[model samples]
Target chain A: MKREQGAARGLAQRMGIPGPMGGAHMELNGNREAVVEGCGGILEYSEESVRVRTGKLAVRFVGRGLRIKCLAADSLVVEGFFTGIEFLW
Target chain B: MLAGLARWLLGSVTFSVFPQGGRRGAGERFFSLAARSGASLWGVRRRGEAFSASVRAGQYAGLRAPARRAGVRLRVSRRNGLPFWLRACRRRKGLVAGGALAAALLLWMPSCIWSVNVAGVSGPQAQELLAQAELLGLFPGVPRGDIDPDLLQQSLMRRYPDAGWISVNTRGSVATITLSERVETPPVKESGRYYNVKAARAGQVVSIHATEGEAAVSPGDAVAEGQLLISGVWEDVYGASHLSHAAGEVLARTQRTAEAEVPLRQTIREPTGETVERRSLRVFSLQFPLTAVPAPQEGYSCTARVETLSFGGVSLPVSLYIERWEGFQEREVVLTEEEAAAQAWREIQAQTDAWEGVELLRAEERAAVQGGVYRLQVQYTGLENIAVESEIFTGGGDEMTGDSNVG
Candidate 1:
C-alpha cells in the first residue's frame, strides 16, 4: 500500500497534480517558521539543527536557534531563524 | 499556542533520563517509541549526559519501558496542570477542609442580621417600638432571610395604635425601622354648662378683655379673692335670664407674700477622700465581678461606669462594668443670721418666679432672728392676668329650658 502511494505521488509529481504524501507539504514563512505535514518522526533535534522523517526522504533544517515548536503524530513545526533546508533519501 | 494550552490542560509530566552508555541514540529511541505509541512529546532538551522531555501525564507510564530498553534511568523532574493539584489536595486533607469551612462562613455571615436600628423615633416610644419589634422576631442575630419587610410593617402598625405610619427597611445585615406617631386631639366641651370667669386673687383690676361674658367690674375696681370678675348670666329684654360660658382675660395688680426660714445650724455631707474601685464583666442582665471587693453600705457613695457595644440601636449582651466607692461623712455647719436670711430670701424669690406672665412691680423683704433660725417675709406686687374659669352647677333640669339657677 505504501508503494502504491509512492507510485501515485511520483505520477502526480510528473503530472504536476497534488496528492497525499506529495513530499510533505513544506511551508517556510517569514524565515522564522517551518511547518511540515505528513511527517513520520524526529530523527534529530537541537538548538541549531533539526532532522524530521517523511515517507520517502529525511528533511534536515539547518539554522540558528532552531527548536521544535510543536511535534504531533503526523506534523512537525520548527521555529527559528531558518537559513536552509536539505532533503536526504 | 492552542496545542500547548491543550497539552497543559490535559496535564503533563517532564522527566530527565541519564543514559548508561553515553550512546548518542538514547534520546532518539525514546522519541521513536513515543511517536509509535501515539504520545506526542515536545520541549525536549539535553544537558550533558541527561535528556529531558515533556509527555502527557497519562503517557508517562508508557515511557518507563522505552527508558529501560534504551538503558536509561528515568526521573520525573516536574509535574504541572490541574490533576496534580487535586492529587496534592488529597494528600493534605486538612487544607481542603479549611478551604471548605472558609467558603461556608463567607456565605452564611451575611444571611443573619447582626444589628437592628430604630429610626424616626425616640424617648419612651422608641423603647415601646423596640419591644414591639422583639415580639415580631425582628431583632439582632435573627436570620435576615426570615424577615419580610411588608409583613413586619403591617405587624408593627397593628401593634402600635398610636403610630400613624410605619416602614421597615433592610440593607445587608442592618435593619432600620422608620415610623411616625399619631397625634392626639382634645375633646370638645359642651356649651350647655354655665361657666363663670372669677378672680383668683384680691387685686385692683387694671384691664379686662371679656370674650363671652358681661363685665362685672370696670378697670381700677378693687376686687377680693373668689370674687366673680365676669358674669356668665345675662337678662334679656323680656326680663328672662340666660346663662353662658364666660371666657376672657383679666389683668390685675396683685400682692403676693411668701415667707421662708433657714436654720443657723445645718447638716451636710462631706467626702472623706477614701475610695475603692471594682470592675466586672456585664453580659446581658448578668454581671460577673472581676474583683472580690465588697460593696460599701451607708456612709459610702457608689458610682458606676459601664462600657457597652451597641449595634444599630440594639445594645449587645457584652459590657464592662466599673464600680467606684467614695467615702463620705456628715458634718454640722453654723451660719450667721444675715447669711440665713439671705438664703431664705433666695428660696422665696425662686418660688415667685414660677408664676407665668407675672411682671414684678415692687418687692419688700423683712428679716428677723427667731429661735435659732432666721425668718424672712417677702411681699411681692405683680401685674398679671388672674382670671379663672369655673363651671356653674344648676338643679336637674333640661338644658333647653335655660334654667337660671346657678349654684
Candidate 2:
C-alpha cells in the first residue's frame, strides 16, 4: 500500500498536478484563521499551541487564545492570534 | 452562526475527556478515533488534565468506544439544544399543561366576537341600530359562525328602508356595522282633490301662471294674506262649473319685518367649583357602577367619556364609562347698552334667517335702547313664491261656494 501510494504521488508530481493524498496542506489567513487538510490527527492541544500530524512530520502552531474551530477525520480549522509555525519530524 | 444554530436544533453535548493515568495526548487520540467514526467536534481546548469539546448529540454515544480504546474517560459537562429542553420539560408537567391550555385558548377565543362597533351613525340612531342588531342575534360573545354578514345586512336594510347602504363586516373578534341613511323625498299630493292656491302672506303679485285653475290675480295686483292666487273653481266651455286641484306658480314681492328685544339685566348659569365623578364598567351589554355616588339631580352639567378595552388591535366588549358633573349657580349679569343692542340684532338676524327660499332685495335695521331694554327691528323686502295649497270643501256642498269671490 505504501509503495502504490508513493508511485501515485510521483506520477502526480511528474504530471505537474497536485495529488489529493500527497501530504497535508495548510492555508493561513492573516494571523486569525488556519485550515489544515489531510491532517493525520491532533498531536497536542492547548491555549498556547496546537500540533497536527501530516504525512511524515507534525505542524506546530504557537499562538495565544488558540482554539480548534472545527475538527473532522482528515481536516481541521484553527483560529487564533498566531505568532509562529514550525515543522518537526 | 448558522452552523451553531443548526447544531443547537439538532442537539449537542459538551464533554470532557480525561486520560486514564494522566497520560498526555490521550485527548488527541480520542478525537482522532471519534472523527474517524464520522463524529464532528468543535471548541476543543484543554483545561487542567481534561480536554473539552462538543459533539453532535446523536454522535456522542458512538464516542464511548473510541474513548475506551484511546484510554480516556468521557464526562458530559453541559447539554445544549432542543432534545435537552424537551427532556427538562418532561419533569415539569404543569408547565407543559399550562402552555398547551394557553395555546388552545388562543386558537379558540378568536372564533367568537368580543366587540360590536357601529360606524356612520351616532346618538339615538346608533343606539337603535345596535338594538336592532341585538334582536337579529349579532351581539358580542356570539360565535362568528352563527353570524351571516349578508343576512344581517339584508335584515337591517329591510328595517330601515331609508338606508342608502348597509354593510356588516366581521373580522377576528370585532364586528363592524356600517350604515348610510338615504335622504327622504317629500310625498306628492293627490291632484284629484279640489283645492285653491292662496297667498301665504300679503304681497304684491309679480307673476302668476296657473296650470290647472284660473288665475285669480294679475301682475302688480295687491293681495292680502289668505287671498286666493289661483281658483280651483272654473267654468268649462259648456258653462258647467268644475272644481279641480289648483296647480300654479306665483312669484311675489313680499315685505318681511322682524323685531327682537333684550333686557339689560339677565340671569345666566355659572359653574361652581364643586364636581361629582361617577365611574362605571360595561361588560357585553350589562353595566355596573364602580362609584357609589348617585348622579346629581339638577343644576349640573355633565360630560361623559367611554373607553373600550382592546386585544391585539381588536376592540373588546369591555368598556369603562366616566361621567363628570359640575354644579352650576344662577347669577344676574348686567349688560351694557352696546352689548344688549348687539344681542338683539343677533336675535333679529336669526329670525330672518329662518325664512327660506327668499332672495333679499333690500334690508333696513333700526336699533334703540329704551328703559334698560335694547330693541332691534329689521324690515326686509324680498321676492319669494307665495302660492300655498288650501283644500276646498266639496262634501255635497255647492261647488260655487268654494270660490273666493263667493266666500
Candidate 3:
C-alpha cells in the first residue's frame, strides 16, 4: 500500500495535480472559522484542540472554545478563536 | 440559520456517546465511525468523559451499529424538531380537534352577511328600506348565495316608486344598499271641469289675467275670502251660454297677520343627575337584554349606542346595545321680559316663513305684556297670487235665463 501511494503521488506531481495524501484542503475565514475538506475522520476532540486524519496526514487545530460546527463524511467545519494549525505525517 | 431550519424540518436529536467498559478513545472512534457512515452531525462538544452531538433524527438510529463497533453506548439527551412536536400533540387530542373546528368556523362565517348598511338616506326611509329588504330575503345573517343582487334591486325599486336609483353590493359579511329618491311633479287638474277662480285670502284685486274665464272683479276691487275673482260661466257670440274651467293668475295686495305669545313663567322638565344604564345583545334578528333592570316607561330620556363586532374588516352580526336613561323632573323657570320677547319673535318669524310666495310691501309689529304673558303681533301688506280653483255646481241646469248669460 505504501509503494502504490508513492507511485500515485509521483504521477500526481508530474500532472501538476494535488495528490490525495498531500494534506487536507483547508479554508480559514479570519480567525473565527475553518472548513477542512478530504476529512477521513476525527482522531481527537476537546475544548482546546481538535485532530482530524486526512489520508496519510493528521491535521490538528488548537484554539479556545473550539467546536465542530458541522461534521460530514468528507468535510467538517470548526468554529472558534483559531490560534494555530499543524500537519503531522 | 438555513441549515438549522433544515435540520428542524427534517427532525434532529441530540445524543451523548459514552465509552463502554471504561475504554479510552471510544468517543473519538464513535464519531469517526458515524462520519464514515455518511451521517451528518453538528455542535460536537465534550463534557468530561462523554461527547454530545446533534444528528438528523433519521440518521440517529443508523448510528447504533457504528456506536456498537466503536465500543460506545449512545444515549439520547434531547429531541428538537417537527416530529417531536407532533408526537407530543398526539397525547392531547382535544386541542387538535378544537383548532380544526376554529379554522372551519373562520372559513364559513364570511359566507353569511352580518351587517346591513343603508346609505344615501336615513331615518324612517332607511328603516322602511331595511324592512323591505328583509322581507325580500336580503337581511343580515342571510347567506350570500341566497341573495340575488339584481332581484333585490328590482324589488326595492318596485316598492319605492319615488326611488330614482338603487344599488346593492355585498362584500364579505357586509351588505351595502345605496339609493336616491326621485323628484315628483305635481298633478295637473283637468280642463273639462267647470271651475271658478275665487279669492283664497281677503285682499284688494291688483290685477287679473283670465285665460279661460270672464273677469268677475276688476282692478282696485276689494274682495273677501272665498269671493269669486273669475267666473267659469260666460256667453258665447251666438246667444248661448257655456260653462268652462277658469285658468288665471290674480295678483292681489293682501294683509297678513301672525301672532305669538310667551308666558313669563313656564313649567319645564329638567334633567336630574340620576341615570340608569342597560345593555342588550343583538344576534341577527334576536335580541336579549343582558341587564336585569326594567326600562323606565315615562319621564326618562334614553340614548342608545350600538357596537358591532368585526373580524378582519368583516362586520359580524353580533351587536351590543347600551342604553343610558336620564331622569327628568318638573321645574318652573322664570323668563325675563327680553327673553320672552325674543322667543315670541322667533315663533312669529317661523309662522311668516311658512307663508310661501308672498312679497312683503309694508310691515308693522305690536308687542304687549299682559297677564304674565308676552304677546307679539305682526301685520304686513303683501302681493301674492290669490286665485284658487273652486268647483262650480250648476244644480244640473244646462241653460241660463238671464240676459247677462246671453251676453
**Residue B131's C-alpha lDDT in candidate 2?**
82
TM-score of 3: 0.55
Q: Mark the regions of model 1 whose C-alpha exceeds 4 Å error after superposition.
A: A1-37, A80-89, B1-11, B81-83, B114-140, B149-407
Q: Write the candidate numbers in order of decreasing lDDT.
A: 2, 3, 1
For residues B209-276, write the lDDT of model 1, one tens digit per residue. 99987888899999887788887877789978788888799999999888898999999899999899
Q: Better model by lDDT, 1 or 3?
A: 3
Clash count per candidate: 0, 0, 0
Candidate 1 C-alpha lDDT tens digits along A1-89: 97997788789889989675435777889889988988877788777778888878888999888777656667868898888888888
Best of the candidates, DockQ: 3
Q: What CAPRI-style quality would you assign to candidate 2? A: medium
| Residue B51 alpha-carbon offset, candidate 3, angstroms | 2.5
Per-candidate TM-score, chain A? 0.79, 0.82, 0.76
Two-way lDDT contest, 1 vs 2, winner: 2
List runs of model 3 lying over 4 Å from the truth.
A1-25, B1-5, B20-22, B110-113, B117-316, B320-407
Enumerate residue pairs that collide in model 2. Answer: none
Docking class of 1: acceptable
Candidate 3, residues B338-407: lDDT per residue as tens digits?
9999999899889989999999899899999999999988998999999998876554457433323212
Give the whole-model CA lDDT for all candidates, comma-separated.
0.81, 0.88, 0.87
